[model samples]
Target: MLTDTLRKVDNLMKNKFTAILVALCFCITSVNFTGLLTVSAATYGDYTYKVSNGEVTITGFDDSVSGAITIPAEINGYPVTAIDKDAFYGCDSLESIEIPNSVKIIGEGAFRYCYALTSVTISNGVTTIGEEAFEECSSLENIQIPDSVTSIGQWAFYNTAYYDDETNWADGVLYIGNHLIKADRD
Candidate 1:
């Protein structure tokens, strides 16, 4: 009878140990996945950036930043080559932005939903503006795309006063390098 009781107690302890090991593994996996999501991001000054291949990409702006923002040409001696996806998403108080000449790419949704953004000055070195880069910027009136730009992605400026169908701009048209980009009237 004693041997039978000992065997039962041993089996219960083994089962509990196995359950604990499985739970521990699950917890570790969850933490690792969460770390992967935010691992590349690091804050510098008012921006969160990621550095890869000797270049820096501005990943996001600090929520406290307002009004104007001027991205530096370099961060920690690495050229700021790109503005990463959703870099300035939903920054409603941002009014204007000056992207320096060293930047080469503007990632998808980089400036989307910045309702108060009015003017954007993309300097001469940028080559690509990613999809929906400036979408939903209701107040943005003017943007001068430099000749160096080779690709402007789909809906890059959608829902802005410059591209929306409802509002008629003073010129009643929007032109991109002598090509008709958008027009409200004939």
Candidate 2:
């Protein structure tokens, strides 16, 4: 009878130990997955970005940055495919910027109110330039729109020196490459 009780106790202890080990492993695995999600949210230089479906989108920038900046084609091994609205808005000190070939879209007002922006280079992979993308870039005098761009939103270059310059117009129209920008109805 004593041997029988001892066997029962040993069996109970083994079962409890196994259950505890499995619960502990589950907790550890849960914590590890949570940590991976947090780690995925990262930054590239002064650019705030997010990754989704294996693509990266630049969402914002450091307001204090000055001079020229080149948006990297990839951030943290993910391709930078888009720029969010207002990403560089109010960057008064920015002089120039280059959008890499991996980017496909430029969100609305991406560079709005950048008073000191003078030059912009858009690579060939871009497909769309959003509304008010370069609005109020008062000092922007040089910009290039590649053939890959399929659309430009309303008021994209409003108030920009490039748009205001008379020499940039041909006949009664302003054009960037082969894309018709505006018409001088006057």
Candidate 3:
């Protein structure tokens, strides 16, 4: 009877240890992923932004404020380093924008479908313009893309006046600075 009782205790202990280990693993994963996915956001002036790694990323805009949208170099003391995906999506009143030199990454569809947007002046520090960043900006005709851009996502300038114009093409492709935005011929 004693032997049988000792064996039951041993099995019980092992099961409890296994349960504890599984619980600990789950807690560790939750802590790590929470830090990565739970970004705190704040509003500064016309921008709603998030801060990570001491830099600010613009995530949303106050659509009521329109025309000549000048993205500031910094927000609330942190340097504005990026623009989030779909940040200004469908802000039809936005007529123009000058992406400041502090910004490096422009997220996918960042300025997509801003129908009234007619001009864009990307600063020299910008490196990547995300997919469909300016897609469907029907009025967009004037733009100055700096040589610093290394990657531009597909349809970044599609449906814009600049993309539709043959004068902006070389032979068949629309080359913006040294980056090939689209190819047109046959």
Candidate 4:
């Protein structure tokens, strides 16, 4: 009877030990995978924020130079696709901007407060212009909105030379169709 009882105890211990090992393995796998996912999320979209041309790359601001800045059209054989929010914000000396046809989206506040910005040329294929995209550009004079654009968010060009003068839409004309949205002088 004693021998039988000992065998039962041994079997019970073996089963419990196997269950514990399985649980530990599951916990380790869960923790390892969670860590890997967190790292991926942090680095997923980090590459789309800067402008690079292999020969010359520009990002954020140009504290060394005080005058005009020209972002490259291509970077490392890849066409420039995105200009991050505030990429050129507060560039007071920026007199003009030329966005290439390769660009698809201009993030919020991308060109905010370019006090000296007078000319802007947006190339084809751009579909969306984010809010405050060109806000507070007081000196901006000529703006060409491509027909490919479908939506213009609120305050996208607010407090700028385009909308500052309510009486004169001549200074700024939103080009949508083959026609322009202008004031009727009738």
lDDT of 1 by residue, 94-165 (tens): 999999999999999999999999999999999999999999999998787898898888778888877764
Highest TM-score, which number? 3
Clashes of 4: 1
Sort by lDDT, top down from the best: 3, 2, 1, 4
Candidate 4 error regions (>4 Å)? 1-59, 63-69, 170-186
Cα error, candidate 4, residue 67 (Å)? 4.6
Candidate 3 residue-wise lDDT, 70-150, digit = tens: 999998778999999999999999999999999999999999999999999999999999999999999999989999998
In terms of TM-score, how similar is model 2 to the real structure? 0.76
lDDT of every predicted structure (CA atoms): 0.84, 0.90, 0.91, 0.65
Model 3 spans > 4 angstroms off? 1-38
* Candidate 4 accuracy as TM-score: 0.60
Q: What's the CA error at residue 166 for candidate 3, in Å?
A: 2.1
Please tell me which model should have the higher lDDT, number 1 or number 3: 3
TM-scores, all models, native as reference? 0.70, 0.76, 0.78, 0.60
